[model samples]
Target: MDFLKLPKRTSGNRTYGLTSIADFGTPIGRLTNILDDYSHIIDIAKIGIGSAYITPNIKKKVDLYKEYNIKPYCGGTLFEKCFYQKKIPEYLTYLKTLGIDWLEVSNGTLDIPLKDRLNVIEHAKEEFHVIAEVGSKDCNLEMDITKWKEEMQIFLEAGCEYVITEGRDSGTSGIYQSNGQVKSELIEELVKGMDVKKIIFEAPTSKHQMFFINQVGPNVNLGNVKLDDVLVLEAQRNGLRSETFYLEDADANYVNQTPTH
Candidate 1:
């Protein structure tokens, strides 16, 4: 039985539907190995938080992803550093020089005023397609759902591409309960009036993955996915995973046997 339909998405270079990979300094050769195998399954490769800065072979990594037709975006923490140091212009310029076509502007770690955040999004939009993030790294900073939803709306209006929900490197932080499950009530609240396509849920673990996929569907956009797990995630998208898809399979057969004809 057909239990899942992977993102029969609008091809690569898509705006709404995207599969992003987080590069945790996997060697360029490894990147090529994965890309060569499933380039069509991947969309974006984010060099998570200045890892490339330490690696220093930035150009080679950038070329490899682009060659495979994967758009490369930098983590927002790197952008935050540049913004805090008043080097926003130079950072934006440097991103262009390195052949980075997409970027993330987030205040996950710092206090960025609304106007300033919009300016950063606008600034990035001039050259790079920007995915603005709307969550704090500090869980103590209580999340105001209404405010976050409003800010996401404004971002969409301002020509930004997506509003990435925070999952951090470890999915146990913001939005997710300490046990690594997303707060179901909060997720209902967040998705209420938002365009589901524009909100990227960061489901880093299998539990988080099941929660979000069960909450939404196979088409839900997820982020912070490890480079190695892209195909696994894709399998989940197709109900190829025994745990998630098997349930979907049973349900399908049950429905088929129901009195219809």
Candidate 2:
């Protein structure tokens, strides 16, 4: 059987075209079932905001993600909580015990200074692969595009493997308007001003996912994806969904071909 050629995607432990799932306390059995089917396309599983501390069988869940070669780490908000309590050292120790090697250094809900955050990133880089996040989670908070670009660059220089643009799981903040529409102008400027491959845009909805895939091609790194949306997102990425069916790489001839009996 022949398959139609679709848009090519980065595969097998991708650095780009990453799909990061936000795990909000999925049961180990359910998570294992999901990974068995979709682990090839899933790169990162973020134990959503402070839940890792309270979730049952946390070690087993983390180890399960690792077994499928997915990098599982606690959410940035958890890091902020640790920072607020001045327990960052203890947080690192806790993560080490869980076999987590990726860390998200972010200041979305907290007011940690840029210098302090960079210092943390630099220090954390020695032991973990850091992915720093920029922008606030509050929809009412406004941030300058110039500052966003500058901070992302500095984070990369500070040894962050990727810098996340903080469109929260709701898709209503940071790189998005209060109504969940993307800040297109801001995104355009960001794409032009930096190495897009190093930036992960949090796109939790179908609309958000399609927009990023269309704007940055299928290989754009996206985060905050729900576990259930994984397969649909991959379908959209490869032009298997209506949203991305007209991607540039799609074959025009296939559409125009005459039918045969």
lDDT of 1 by residue, 154-243 (tens): 988998888888878788766776566676777887766777777888777766776665566555678888887888877776666765
Judging by lDDT against the true structure, name the best candidate: 2
Model 1 misplacement above 4 A: 1-13, 246-261
- TM-score of candidate 1 against the unseen true structure: 0.88
Clashing pairs in 2: none
Which consecutive 10 residues in model 2 have the weakest lDDT in total? 252-261
Q: State residue 57's C-alpha deviation in candidate 2, in Å.
A: 0.8
Worst 10 residues of 1 by lDDT: 252-261
Find the number of clashing residue pairs for candidate 2.
0
Rate residue 225 of model 2 by lDDT. 97
Q: Please list the residue runs of candidate 2 whose C-alpha ends up more than 4 Å from where it truly belongs after superposition.
A: 248-261
Clashing pairs in 1: none
